[model samples]
Target: MEQHYQLLRKHIEEICVLTDEEWDVVAQRFTYKSLKKHQFLIQKDQLVPCEYWIIKGLTKAYAIDSNGKEHILQFAMEQYWTSDFNAFQNKVPATIIIDCIEDSEFFCLKWEDREYLCHEIPKLNHFFRIKSHYGYIALQQRILSLLTETAEERYNNLIKKMPKLIQRVPKKLLAAYLGVTRETLSRF
Candidate 1:
């Protein structure tokens, strides 16, 4: 899992100036795994045990609608973290599914380990608080976009944010994420 440590170190370094010692502490908590395409990282209605940091390939967090449609909430690429924080926090069953879109490698950390970080290194608390704040803001922005933006607008935004995913994610999945039909997405 040295690769996982390196990836985490890079992310921590970007977020805050992490000393080698601090990085070591973070590194010790990571567990690495390889996932096949279409396999789940976190399945719907299951308890979230860990949060993952993507080291390779792609993954997405989504929810199934009442009509059995999958609505993508977020996508993670290399260096990104994916998890259902609500379930992780409350020890409740997850309402979302986190699935790999490709053969993926990830560094995972359990909830208890994160709590230890806060207790062991106070600076990490600041770092995590900021991370959580951004998560909240991003979620809010997504909700607003779903309410205000047209399907084409959402699709265009997705391309701007993750241009590669247009070719990587299945077209039907992409369309559902953007609240468009597959034919409409194809036309665009």
Candidate 2:
């Protein structure tokens, strides 16, 4: 957990500069946790109590379709945030699952704690607002891609955005993300 602190501090400072004293205040609110490969951080239909920031490793947020097929909504790597946003925001049951893809370590920031911190540190409000804006833009692009892009095009776009990521994920998971069979992803 001590080792994870530096990474978390760095990520936050990149978005909003913080003095050491301010950082100490910022860090104190987070709870450190670790998860093994395939372990779930948040499961469908459960209440999401916190949002996680990855210190190391990978996770995927996904939903199981009516046919029991998994559809990957997002893959979060080091320095990324993972959570069922609707559940977290509304205090409702989760509609998706967030699970580790590898042995992972991260920090969890509870909703009430986040709200408190943001109010205490006004800069944090700006920081989160910027992050939320980007999240919206990315979601829009994803929706557009799903609506109109071919699987190969989606693969190419992912490659452009996250070249290192494609190699790390299993082919089957990549296929799920692309909304295609493994064979189709391999062809791409």
- Candidate 2 C-alpha lDDT tens digits along 1-188: 66789888888888899988888889999999999999999999999999999988999999998999888999999988889999999999999999999999889999998998899899999888888888889889999999999999999999999998998899999998888999888786
Candidate 2 Cα lDDT to native: 0.91
Residues 1-188 of candidate 1 have per-residue lDDT tens digits of 66567767877766677777887787787788899999989987899988888889999898888998778898788877789989988999999899889999988889999899878878888878887888789888889989999888887888897798888888878887788889999888
* Candidate 1 Cα misplacement greater than 4 A, ranges: none
> Which candidate leads the pack in lDDT?
2
Model 1 scores a TM of: 0.93
Off by over 4 Å in 2: none
- Backbone clash total for model 1 is 0
Q: What is the C-alpha lDDT of each candidate?
A: 0.85, 0.91
Q: What is the lDDT of residue 139 in candidate 1?
A: 83
For model 1, state the Cα shift of residue 107 in Å: 0.8
Best by TM-score: 2
